[model samples]
Target: MANQSELDDHYTRMDKIFRLSLGEKGAYSCARFDGDFSMTTEAAQLKKYQFIEEGCKIKKGTKMLDIGCGWGHFVDYLTKKGVDAHGVVLAKGQADACIKNGLKVKHMDSKLITPETFGKFDAVTAMGSPEHLCSVEQYREGKQEMIYNTYFKQVADLLPIGGRYYCQSMVFGPKMVKFEDIKFGQTDLWKKEFTDEELMDIICEVFPGSWLPYGKEGLINPASKYFKVVSVDSGRLDYIETIHRWTAAFTAFNLQKYLLFASFVPDYLFDKTFRRWMRRFKIQANLHVFTREIFEHYRIVFEKVSD
Candidate 1:
């Protein structure tokens, strides 16, 4: 899994850009669109949440936990509907914001979640979290499958028989470049001198210490041990639309975000690590990967059927 520091580097420090671009309580993950991209992103996000609510059979009194709950948007939404919604975020900024907004959230590691910690939840959702379950180093060490399997077991431990788990993640797609082709920590200017494969390497540069699963099966296979697959849907197009919307907002003038970015100018000029990190924004690498299907998004629901 991506360590706390790496996560903070990407999420905590850049929280403003995310919030500014998507608004205070916007959905940071891909919104759902059932072949109808015409709807506004907010509407699509509500649809996505509705799908989750129905899939989990959640009601006014249902207890739920949202893992990797960035900004606590879903948490706030559920709470408004009278559900007992709690969220856990690794990013300090997000947790603080949730608290400030009077949302139920804790700044803690998702892996530490257990019955002992917060007791059982009727349903658990891990939106955009599983992508960080395995780091590049862990993959290279051939521990990827074991890591995912263990994660499934941990999640199962937090649920009773028939409990539901909604998990959204980006998995390595067919077009993903070979592992060896990817490079890292090189201070080479963004897009200055890089081949197609090397350009793909910029993914790790932006989301340091994070690696994705191969395909939906990469998630279902391990999860089969403790849960039964309920539904699986390709969210590729929804993500494309979501990215396009976010790109527009990000490129739009935001004094605070720009000023925050400007402060990094000195680091970008002198620090190699910061320079590499900055490269992710120079060209918006996320859109490239999602557009090319180098990363495939999956929205899945799993039912805990066994211990």
Candidate 2:
């Protein structure tokens, strides 16, 4: 188990690596993660918005707060429907992009939020970002419980009695998947070029990420102490579809990069090989679809109880 300093260092390194791999523009483009650029046709985006609207019981002119609002997509969507929407994002690049796109967003961490700066929001939503909490070892050490409790307690404090908080997260799926088995292009090379163990080794070699499929039990159980669970939606199918789209878009982007910069043979070869590996990810995602019991994602809606 890593200490707090170690965990912080890991996150700092991860932030740098992610920013380098997914430039400002590319990351925003892939935020929807299903390759649908048009908002009208974006099933995933639309579903998320729909969930927010329904769960919050939002009305025209209702005030809303979005946590981890990537590129302010949900803010724009809500505002377009006549809801007064505000958002906070930790990524300066994403916030800048949103501003350039004429959307309003505050740059701040979720833990830093308060009713003073944000005012009271009628509803709050966080999508697929809470997993950024401390590492699994920290959770086992009991720090995770305190962290999550404080997070929800803050959200509850920011809302009126009966106000709502909606969240979508990658929860514990049916089975525990090793990080190595799911990484891009490592195992799927030329006819099982790498075994599952080899893939796991490669994952550990390249990254120190972890995956836990706890379903809604851990998050929902604690949150229910302070809020009532109104709805729980599963996203295993959607997640699989999302990954397939991401792999496809990434493949296209890398191919274009290779064609434009052929002088970089090593990079080109890596892209070519990586594309083949992405196909393996598609297979794994599909496997989850068939056995959702072993793998699942969740969208949970909760309403604060008045103190």
Candidate 3:
């Protein structure tokens, strides 16, 4: 997958946009939304945190470790609820923000975590981290299962029996097109839609060294040896809604936000590659979901089991 530098550089370029679109908390993951579309992005994000709390059986005084805790929103939520919550992230911008807000967060890779590194925790939650745990290249090299198993074992070692691990991530959906068969700027996937090859390129730029799991089983099977899946839910539609709201947020930008956008004009006008990737990454994610069904989102809770 992506080395630490690649991951850091990728996030450095896009963190500002995420901060603008996701609001003060800087949440960057899918939000929960349904027929009742009245909830704001912040509210929906809190709902997601609530789901994690309930799923992991987190209560007051519970010691919880949040891996890849973007902007520390979940940690903030849990801490306010009287839970002893701590977070770790690889993004510099996110870690700085969380620290500035007086939250307990570390700027480091989650994969480096071990019982020796952080000691045993009562519970662990990886909101959007597992998707980055392995890359497509790693998977092609026959290392996906091994990587996942090792990751699960790390979490297992950090939790006592019956402790929980909550994970939410994007997984390959049904009818997915083969990787090699996917074309650039082609319309075969949809009646009148073109799959921009550049879109994939930009995605690579945006996420650098990350890849998604093939399906829920990709996670469940590997984790089965260490933890038992307690609950699983398809959050695909919720993600679709979350994306639309993000688009609207950027579109409804005000003067202050416009100033923020204007600051990037120099990069847009000069750094052609970065500009194109930045714009396309935002646009293509929504398009791919509707037209290609490239992936599905899932939220799962796994309880540690003694083996």
Candidate 4:
């Protein structure tokens, strides 16, 4: 694990890289990054709107809150369906884009929300945000319960009775590979080249500000306290598919950029090497799926119980 300063620096770099990768368009339009777009349109149609449609059963003219609405995709979807959709995002660029696209999205942190300021909604969704809460408590004895309990308490506060909450995140898989085993090597041919440690180090380096502390057990246990887990769905196949798409897209983009600039062969080689490793990682992710083991992505739907 990195020290506080190191982590801070790493997040700063990540923000820069993310901005570059996304450009002024803060939305991740690539179908692969978001399952709703990557999977077949029919599959996305079934799952993407499943939670909201189910929650709509509780109230008509429903007001929905998207806790970390990225580019207002869900909000747009809801608005079209005649639901009053509002969203909060920490990224200014994303907020701006959402506004420009005629969506009601605000730039705010989840912790800053209040009953008066944000108002209660029929539904709320974190969508992969809660896992970013800082904690090592899950690895300790009694502390684990305290840390996770507090998390659920906060979530419960934001929801009213009969309100629904939805979330998607990467959870601890059944097989916890040591941080060192998943690396692949740099070879011209298609082969796994780096070690798992190297991959984790790169991820840490790239996303320093991220805090992904919750595992499968940690998340479900805490959530069970305040909400009834209606369903838990795995999206590992989506992740594997997404990464492969990213590898291909980045490779193609790099090659095109190099060719346009000055025909830099070295850049092409670097991209090719990265694509090779990414392919291997995709295979490993798929293997986990086949085993019904731990998954990299999971979506949970919950209903708030009466206080």
Best by lDDT: 1
TM-score attained by model 4: 0.66
Error of 1 at 207 (Å): 0.8
TM-scores for all predictions? 0.93, 0.69, 0.90, 0.66
lDDT values for all models: 0.86, 0.60, 0.77, 0.55
Give the residue spans of candidate 3 off by over 4 A: 182-193, 196-202
- TM-score ranking from best candidate downward: 1, 3, 2, 4
- Name the best candidate (by TM-score): 1
lDDT of 1 by residue, 174-246 (tens): 7888888666655355445555465566778778788899989999999999999999999988898888887
lDDT of 2 by residue, 117-160 (tens): 86899998887556555454554465766767777788888899
Give the C-alpha miss distance for residue 40 in model 2, angstroms: 9.0
The residue-level lDDT of candidate 1 at 161 comes to 98
Residue 295 shift from truth in candidate 4, angstroms? 5.3
lDDT of 4 by residue, 85-114 (tens): 888766555666678778888876665677
Which of 2 and 3 is the better model by TM-score? 3
Between prediction 1 and prediction 2, which has the larger TM-score?
1
